[model samples]
Target: MSLGDEHGFGSESGDRRSDDSFGGSGQTRTRLPGGGDTDVYGGARRPVRNSRSLITVVGVVVLLIAAIAFANQGGGEEGPSGDGAKGTGSQPTAATGVKPVTGKNGQIPTGYAKDEQGAQSAAANYAVALGSDGMFKSATRRDIVQTVHDPAVTDGLLSDLDKAYSADFLANVGLTGDGSAPAGLTFVSRTVPVGTKTTSFAGDKATVEVWCTGLVGLAGPKSTKPVTETWFTITQNLKWVGNDWKIGSSSQKEGPTPVNGDNRASSADEIAGAVQGYGGFTYAR
Candidate 1:
């Protein structure tokens, strides 16, 4: 089975001082002929200086002051809140503040809550574990399957996966007979969650689709299967088991992918370094 086709679940501001002086020094003021009260230009004696104009200017100034006061009172446009948007009223893209489980079943995260959010979290975390480079190894692969799969189906799933990730399959992706990279190469398989949606959820069951982008292949000079990115969605049929969420079954499909941009691909060494340096997260929604 094609792994790619199957699992479908898936700025500084400067302050300026204002000058109060209306006119520059050494500028001469001309007086009108009447009583030095009007200018020589005689522009209708400044129109008797209407009190209504003064009132209107004062009204405008008052309105501006009120606006400034209201804005300051409302905290200046309600910028991004703790969850990262201004007045969005939407849930956070990722879980926060909720402490991760100290409990793990082998390498898989465990102790998830018995709720829809918990099920989504479990599926997302499991997707990462299942898509990691560790899945290529016999020991870790078995651990992962046992941890994530429903107990009733674990044995058969393991058997199927063993055959599916066979020596030839490993070799095609640049691993040796024992699933090790060539001496100079670093094998990479990493899945990063883009988002998750729960298509169906109940107390006892859940179906979660995890959208992800992954990097797989071998990273190094002279490697044939140079690491490349792919997008896929993994749909996991999960059941509430052992007080947590476990995978009953899963299938993957290609993608609701976007057009690739013009970004220059990173060098193999750079990719290797990055994979080694940056750690993956325990995803939740």
Candidate 2:
């Protein structure tokens, strides 16, 4: 029962910022010390829960149970990267054969490594996966929901991500009913990590910061979705469970993002066509 799941759904927002209930500056939404409901933050009014603060507490219990089940199911998959290694106390070993993805949950198993480098690599890749265009499709979304997320957190996160990437949002991105681009157009939504850092780590818990640059828009004539780029930071509060790191909670904020470079902006049609034709990569450290 991750705190996220206990809440029922990610906090509702009034705008794009609202969709990111965890980051924007608003009143704090807190689950009560006991089971109940209450509103903690706001811009537009949303129902609030003041339930037992034990929501996250309970979610952890559920997570512990799920992890055990997951481990028992397959003895837990080993970290997909290198054997834990230490160097001149400098950068970490870049493990080969890193599976950016495995099962559908979108959980990056790379984080449970025995060392820091492994964690960093895992965190960066996980962030990219979470923010990728794959999040838009229903099938992939199901896989992501099952594979990457903690079971306790899955219910809530799935609901939120669903709303955040709803049909209306797909239309906003100039996609058809299933998030597919119309003929002669392309759709893009990807996060490119600039760097990653561990802000804090303890036992199986870590806070990893992923500095990323992303592009999101539809490229096509008469498309309203412009191929625009933005910078943001994704901070994931991860926990080591079932032999890998799983996001307990996550947040995103507008970045220390730099000014636009001299890169010429492409027309909607050009950008859309390229997006339709080109493919995104599985990012790594």
Candidate 3:
């Protein structure tokens, strides 16, 4: 799962020209239309509003006004602004009036402490849920996507993710074509966020980078996919939505991993047995 040819197998490539699908059919099939032929503003000049044209100038002014109004609204709720821009979740806040942790609709934890530490904790935990094995399944994938991602990006992200988890993609992970467990076997894929750093914070919009270690493989008799560990970094631009941190956008990159010494590799059976026998941890700050 983690060891793959393409980095953005299930992720939406930032390139607007690429056909990046979210969760439509899976990674192997179904390519969603992006900023290529289907993209409306893929041409040169970046489709800027022209000041020479009255209509274009008016449109540009309107957009600027709208953005200002939105930022003002966000700033009001956050009380005050710090070094960075408003509406980003980067500004430091007093812990006063902040409540203890609360679970998200009986699932995730929400309403983190109004301080730097709390935000970091929230980012780490949310990253884990976003990068878990449940993302491969349709039903659980929907829940995790809806819960973790910002609402604005949900539609596009869901579409792209659908294509990322296609039958072929699942097969590559050693699961059945439909992303199910094979008879007498178990599949494992999980992400553990080791730490988090805030890159930018304004209001509810904050960009956090999660240093992570992932475990992925198949555990069962006759299973050739051995569970393996990988180090990577996941960056999430999150927005505070409905009292919880929701991911507005996310991207992954290969790690600052350490070099490995020549070590004896475990047998396939041993790997399978360990994967099936051991459960993952509930990561937190």
Which numbered prediction scores highest in lDDT against the true structure?
Answer: 1
What is the per-residue lDDT of model 2 for residues 166-200, given as tens digits with 9 covering 90 to 100? 46544533556674656655545555667888898
Scored against the true structure, residue 86 in model 1 reaches a CA lDDT of: 14
Candidate 2: count of backbone clashes, pairs at least 3 residues apart or interchain: 32
Higher-TM-score candidate among 1 and 3?
1
What value does the lDDT take at residue 161 in candidate 3? Answer: 51
Task: Score every model by TM-score.
Answer: 0.66, 0.61, 0.62
Clashes of 3: 36
Give the Å error, residue 111, model 3: 2.9
Best by TM-score: 1
**TM-score quality measure for candidate 1:** 0.66
**Each prediction's Cα lDDT score?**
0.48, 0.42, 0.42
For residues 1-285, what per-residue lDDT tens digits would candidate 1 score against the true structure? Answer: 012212211000001001000000111223344443333122222222211111111101111111111100000001111012212332223454465565666445688877767877887778676655555567766786778778887776666555545576555445666656777776665566778889998779999877766555556677655455545556678888888888876655445556554344567677666656555554434
Candidate 3, residue 125: how far the Cα is off, in Å: 1.3
Error of 3 at 72 (Å): 41
Alpha carbon lDDT at 240, candidate 1: 88
Q: If the candidates were sorted by their TM-score against the true structure, best first, what order would they fall in?
A: 1, 3, 2
